[model samples]
Target: MESQHSSTTTARAARAPLVFVLAAAVCAAALGWTYWAFVQTTTGQFADESAWQEAGVAAPDTQLPFLRFLDTLPTISVVIAAAAILFVAVRRHRYGAAAIAVAVIVASNLTTQLLKNVVFDRPDRGVATLDFNSLPSGHTTLAASAAAAVFIIMTPRWRPFAAAVGGAYSVLAGVATYINLWHRPADVVAALLVVGIWTLIGGLIIMRTGNRWNDWQGFGTGWASSRGWLGLCWALGPGSLVLSAVLYFSVQAIGPAPVPGTATLPLFFWWGLAWIVGVGFTLSAAAGWLFADQARRTSARAVVP
Candidate 1:
């Protein structure tokens, strides 16, 4: 009886994170598909082309100076991620997790950039307004990097949860770029696809190597305290995503989206509903509450370490 009970407890503990990662994947695919083609599929609307064309708006390439500056985000994200892996190496002294994190982050980021320029580069309508491989987005790629990096070392079950949180942030990143006019609706969709495909590849690698997923363990707040990190994430993470989506879609519905600085803002509105209400807050809140509820019962059943 004692051995059986211990085995059950161990199994449950390992299952949690995998659940989160899976959940994230579902939410990402659903939401991503919606923004990328929800209305169009149902109503035959091609806003990316129609919205601007009817209004005589023309899409333009990223400006040289700004493009040069913004192009550094991928690099910055990579550097920060490298340091994160280094910290894990020096502190935990775990080569497995450190190596996986470093390798996945670098490979995924580089692959996305290369695909962006090589496979996706094209001039539509005598200009680079659109490209074929642009279906997956790099902004979302970075977002995935930030989120997936955490999960790659964790148990398989935790992915859904990470995806839940990570996917929201990924969507938020896409929206922010869209707001800043850095990418089009299609670009955002492409970003999500890119991240999903690469991250899935990474997950498969982990699975093949037999590394289990880890629970968030939740980061510390800016005060450098674990509790502080939880508090900050609890307060700002959801809220920030909500605010960012609200603003993005609100602007989207109001104007001629797919065009910069003067389109609709309805998309932000849908974004809020999908993320804050659908996944981020509503679903996430319920998930967190349930996880906490389960955690207590779980703790009573087994030793953590």
Candidate 2:
């Protein structure tokens, strides 16, 4: 009995740090995003200008209809998405997972509201944009929170595919906001960080509450266990970062005159979008791996004498 207890303790200890790491990652990303948006003048201008440029690019008559539909995507869509995810969890008889999904959605959206409305003030940082508080976009938060909730309720075997689909949904939503000129890239990034933090908490809760339902079958030949989705994100994430860095320096080398509202902003805007998407995918892949690892440990423990 003592040995069994010790083994369980060891497993818990091992899993705790992964949770801590994910939580810490959210904090770090949030801070870094803030500093980039508010402090770094050049970077801020690039993102701001690029956003307007992206809007210009999407302003064509041909794309306006689709863009308009995406822009008008009501809050009810978020509610419906969350309800659908909750139904999946409840149907699986994973009540804890359902609760965690709800908590993550609520907490993440609340955090975005708090930051946008009360906590953070947009001081006159001498950037070439309106002096309004736009950090942690509400729309991006809505989309990312829904996606994170879906990821939490899925079983380990299905998580990889869910992570891929969910991450894509989130990235598309964020980019759509950008195309419509609703938010800056930093706003999207901040929202992603907020959702990531809440998702980590939800994942921990699910790990403890429904280990049997989330058992990690060994990585066999199937696409789910093969982890092809994770592998794609892992490669794309770093590759996108490298591409963004290269674009940043190349643009800097040209030293385009700080002409406010120039057509050149589109270049940086697309680059910023890519960077934020990479960040989202990277976090999704990491979270998926962490959950699978925890479930695997639980499965091993169950089989032991």
Candidate with maximal lDDT: 2
Which parts of model 2 are misplaced by more than 4 Å? 1-14, 21-23, 26-29, 35-43, 58-66, 72-80, 263-265
Write the residue-wise lDDT of candidate 2 on 1-305 in tens digits: 88877666555544565665656576667656664664355556555655555565645453466476566655644775667676876576667777778888899899899878887776665556667778787887888888888888887888888788778777777777766777777777788888888888778877766645766676667876568888877776767777776766666677644653465445565567677778778877777777777777777766566
Model 1: lDDT equals 0.47
Cα RMSD to native, each candidate? 7.7, 2.9
Candidate 1 vs. true structure, TM-score? 0.52
Identify the candidate with maximal TM-score. 2
Worst 10 residues of 2 by lDDT: 256-265
* lDDT, each prediction: 0.47, 0.71
